[model samples]
Target: MSRRVLIKTLPLHTNYGGIVQAYALQRAIRDLGHRAVVDTGDPISLRRRVLHRAWAVRRAVRMLLPARVDWDWRASREVLAPQQSFVRRHLSRASAVERADTRRGRARLARRFDTFVVGSDQVWRAAYAEIPEQFLEVIEEFHGPRPRRVSYAASFGRDDIDEYSEAERARATELIRRFDAVSVREESGIGICADAFGVHAERHLDPTMLLTPGHYRGLVARARTDPTPAAGRTLVYRLDATDDMLRAERAIAERVGAPAMELLPTASPGSYGEYAADRARFDRPSVERWLASIASADFVVTDSYHGCVFSILFNRPFVVHANARRGAARFDSLLGVFGLEHHRAGASADGIDDRVFTPDWSHVNRVLEAERARATAYLVENL
Candidate 1:
């Protein structure tokens, strides 16, 4: 008996990790012989599209005001073209099917699926984005009072629920209690489920890690034209640009004995230092090219959870810049899985005690295989 499962996660955007996770989960579901459907994308109205374009132009103009604000809209536009092209090529098959951003649209979309899944990102966190209150409404739009509802690898992105307001806490508690099954990407999220929501949530690996290295290598193979980072280059894929993260990145680069290839392109105004140049290079590579860069890099240094996940998947030696501002506990939880916790670095880079930069791949692989089995079983049982 086949079932149509609708995955209700974050919208597909330019974020490499987000896109990859969505792809992996859908692939994993389909591998179990279940049919999975994700909304193609939200339909932006003409008025909103005009406002977005206007906002982009206004910001671009403000950046060009005198202080060498270090921004370029042309570069941004050019960079986004390839990123979107990647989506159209790889994800459009399963995803280019629905766009439900309205009441009638959601109701119509609900009629096409038998089950609904909500998860696999910082989507549980209110501040990650301005996700509409109606994202959960799709589940209720079903013909019955209850439709199969599961949350897979959902993350609150923090150690505590104190960030949510009183009303938010109540809403989360009520909504999560309705979930037939619940699994979170981070260990801390388990505690959040118990303490904040009174819901028992199992801890599961991020969907990206559910796939094998060969799976990612295949993506890279298909993207043959995408240039990878130069061999022996230290890939610096930071999500946050704190002074401590920069120091941590430099130290890892030195330890790896290679020139650093910084991949992220975000910098705040008036910030000085080596990362200042990042603002001018906002053209983050296509998702496939980004994967290629990580796969080929001699070593990786990152403050991103997905960065560490990809480094492990690609067998790249790496160090984690455990930036507290970006939820440092996530680093601890991810590294703990492969016994690579020593690879974590603090603001001053002192927390990193793993002198031998590389982990025991044999040990990590064994752990990966075991965890992958458990994670897969979780998907199977729930599906």
Candidate 2:
């Protein structure tokens, strides 16, 4: 009953949603009385790898200079320090030996973890993949005496496979079939799995939805200086804030009679010199602080998948700006989960739709309670 579990997900870093979702799944597994550790230190993109190496050399020379120059490496270390610290504090991580990418490495991995889970994010999207095999390497690379493989709420980012080539689709089908269980985060994903892989996949909640809002509030309370319980404030969280989105946020704030706070990406790149040294491109809120902003908000308007997730978890009345580029199908699937798809709409100038702010909390909670039970049952049966 007490099996060791290894969680395979998008590399934990600045992406708040990615980090929180990974945290949620691992936490969920451990709460079930199983040992779970998330695998970290994943390979970076080729461009980033090259940039990091260049920065390392520059940093070495700058350290010896009369006037020290702040490079990306040092600044990045500062920005990600809190996030790294959070992972260490809140989650168990695989040691380097257990995370090795070699045959011997996987052997060590197989010996430690009885089951491997790839999930709770866009793990199957090739464009989003850092490692060559993407998240599929858990099964594709480990050849001998493989661990039980499961995909919990794994997403291809979109229902359409326009970005996935014919070859990638073929390989994905092969790797997908190897999983003992498969659950997708979107209803549209269920059909994609059936049609593409010829395997039945269940639609499940995003891992963050598995936990209660109180659990997240507890995290917010841990922050030393992070503000929490923001009363009478409308939170604007957008991946790409267009003019329309901004106007919508302003209108929503005006209508609600609450001040608006824009929560932009703290991890935006391009910081150098004294200005970069003195200030980050944006204030890098600790992981808990980021959650606190959402947890405490009176209302939220976001284009992010995870933004929508937290709003629902906190039972905040909110509308999503359909981010079709990142994956609008996910929004469709997520809102459809609570039968609240009308909650997503374009933020046009004429007016922000009335449905954006009026939500039936009682009905949403009823659906969430039932869905959480179904999702937990799937996890219990699998891990």
Candidate 3:
């Protein structure tokens, strides 16, 4: 039987992983014969919107000024605009619910769906945990016939559970207990949920892994093909680009005898060195463009989790740098899944092998198939 399923996750345009994972999960649900929709709930306050407008105005002024602006403001706008437009045009299918921050808003919205999913990202983290709608706090507190509340691959963003205050921990415990079924993205998250909520949560693959590489190929095929795609080049997709990281990327590129190219974030707020500035830069890459870049790369160096994910999917040789600020648990869990823990790059770029190392795809695919089956089973049974 088909049911109306509503998924609540981070904002669609926040980053590539968030957007792709949201689309992947919704697609997976639809593949299972249910009508799925991503609920881009209205949670931003009016004050924040005003501040955003003010920032945009300031940026526009800076772009028009005589002083040479290092930032590729026009490129960033061009890249990001199409991405948002893609989501609005191709990804989202349901009319979004307005006023989701209040009880009245959630109550009104709940009546429209038979089930609610909170997942495929850091929805369980402290930052979004308090949001009644995102964490299913509203569904847990619903007075009328409550919709089926399930969490799929939800990450706490860290291994430690002590980050929450005593009251907040209590509330989280209460809310999580009300979930019909809870699945976490990382293995560590299972323990955190168990320790904090005294509830056992299953470990599931990230939504990106839920789909096969062939499914992603379709998206890449649709992307506007690059007229002059780079060959035998190292594609560096770093979320936290430090001076040392940039140096390491250059060294690797030199060792491999390939040019170094970077996929610039839509809103990276840092200065690049002369070496980095000299290399090619892809600013504000759309999801399709991002996928195509990774698919065509000879090798990849990245600190982003999804970066690691697509590299694996494409069966590309890649190195994952430790992103301490974003927490290492995500990488640890994912790398451990594919038995690629040795792929983690050290602090220094030296001793990093120059040649592309082939992964054991037969084994990797087996593991992926098993995890995919388990995750899909959970969703099928729950929803």
Candidate 4:
């Protein structure tokens, strides 16, 4: 039986983590022979970061160059809309569908989608100071109770729901009640929903776990078809990653006696051409090639949860650098989930340690599969 499904998430169409989550869910829905349409609430909104015209010009220039090219057009517009009317107008003009989400427009929009899956990122944070009530208001108007509401891999920090303010707790309770089922990404989230919202949300794995490393191997193979780092070593880093982390990666590569290369998730074709121009010890590969390189590397050093998850999945020894900017506490919460304390700290030049590299994935896999099955069952029944 085929049915239409709508997915609402945070930071969609940008970042490997967000893309992988959205892609995996949509893929799962499609595998079940359903029509899944994923549309996220704007990351930038009237209550969020305000974007300015000057910033827009600077951003437009930045997008044209290889440096500071990690901008996600969607995320940028969402985070900066309140501050920059020019950017809001700019992206709004470019996007025909999302721009019409006015109070008068929402009623008609609600009639279109059969079910809405709201989750897979830091959207729960909206209950905090950063977001406005309108965000939930719009979603509630579009996806009311009994319309097959489900939350896939949502998360809250280690602190209990009592940690939230009265307004936030009230909002959370109401939203959680409206959902048919809510599945969280970490054990902490279960406590949060139960204690704070008075709703029962089961603990589940991040959607990235739904697919095995073997499933991602095709992109890896494609990435390695012609690669200089294929025979040596490589390090993939996200934009927010620090210089110290890169140094640790290089030191590990050097200790292993292999040349090292850097990997970027998003870059222009011409940037790849520039990287190709450099015949030095370091070489850049396509994103697929980068993932392949990590799979085939002497060691992997990253600040990404997916990177850490996949490293363990592939049985590769890795170092997960704490992301200080985003808050290492969240990383700590996730690391605790897999019992991977050794690989969960700040970066160091330490050579690959077998103990840290080796985790009992056999046990982890069983837990992960059960969560995936639960999530799948929710989607299947809702449809």
Lowest-scoring 10 consecutive residues by lDDT in candidate 3? 271-280
lDDT per model vs. reference:
0.73, 0.78, 0.77, 0.58
Best by lDDT: 2
Using TM-score as the measure, the top candidate is 2
Candidate 1 per-residue lDDT over residues 1-383, each given as its tens digit = 67888776777766788888878888888888989866534445557757878998897787566643434444454456677787677653443223444556556655667667776877777777333331354445435344567778887788886667787777767777877889888899999889877889888888888888888878778878454664679888877688777887787677668998878666323332222455455456778778888888898888788898988887888887776776776778888888887777666655677643747889888988898899888878776
Quote each prediction's TM-score: 0.82, 0.88, 0.84, 0.70
What order do candidates take by lDDT, descending?
2, 3, 1, 4
Query: Which is the better candidate, 3 or 4, if ranked by TM-score?
Result: 3
- Candidate 2 per-residue lDDT, tens place, 149-183, comes to 88899888888666787888887888878788999
Instruction: Return the lDDT, model 4, position 263.
Output: 56
Task: Write model 3 residue lDDT over 28-80, tens digit each, in one string.
Answer: 99999999999766454557757877998998887686533455554445446
- Which pairs of residues clash in candidate 4, taking residues 3 or more apart in a chain or in different chains? 43-78, 44-78, 44-79, 50-82, 50-83, 50-84, 51-83, 51-84, 52-84, 223-289
TM-score of 2: 0.88
Off by over 4 Å in 4: 41-104, 127-136, 142-146, 157-169, 219-231, 234-247, 265-287, 327-330, 347-354, 358-371
Worst 10 residues of 1 by lDDT: 267-276
After TM-score superposition, the amount by which residue 267's alpha carbon in candidate 4 deviates from its true location, in angstroms, is 12
lDDT of 3: 0.77
In model 3, the number of clashes is: 0
